[model samples]
Target: MRDIPVLFNNKDECCGCAACYSICPQRAITMSEDEMGFEYPIIDKTKCVCCSICIKTCPVKINAL
Candidate 1:
């Protein structure tokens, strides 16, 4: 499968829940702090397996009502 270059489209779309980070089996997702001090998931392309687990685990996308 083809790998995606980036995970989130907008930084604010993320809820800082760390669901993606925790769900990554390959440890490809790292929680990095933004300028505002909120942690966001940063996907490591080199370590990512293109499993798409991170996308599935994203609460922002899943919890959207």
Candidate 2:
């Protein structure tokens, strides 16, 4: 397994868009609800192929340096 690149380092940076989850070819991304009931992405690194598709799909991640 490889070290998966974390898409969102800050929770606030996420816009709750399911693009990453929807676009994951490896079925590695899951939408998980936070305490506030807002759904965020949870990555299954074990299943992730490190394709970076998730990162590309994330709107917030696009702005990440």
CA-only RMSD, every prediction: 1.8, 1.7
* Residue-wise C-alpha lDDT for candidate 1, range 1-65, written one tens digit per residue: 77753557897788888988998899988999989999988888789888887887777777664
Q: After superposition, how far is residue 48 of candidate 2 from its true place, in Å?
A: 0.4
Query: What is the TM-score (0 to 1) of candidate 2?
Result: 0.86
Candidate 2 C-alpha error for residue 42, in Å = 0.6
Best by lDDT: 2
For model 2, what is the error of residue 44's alpha carbon versus the real structure, in angstroms, after optimal superposition?
Answer: 0.6
How many clashes does the backbone of model 2 have? 0
Clashes by residue pair, model 2: none
Off by over 4 Å in 2: none
Worst 10 residues of 1 by lDDT: 1-10
lDDT of each: 0.81, 0.85
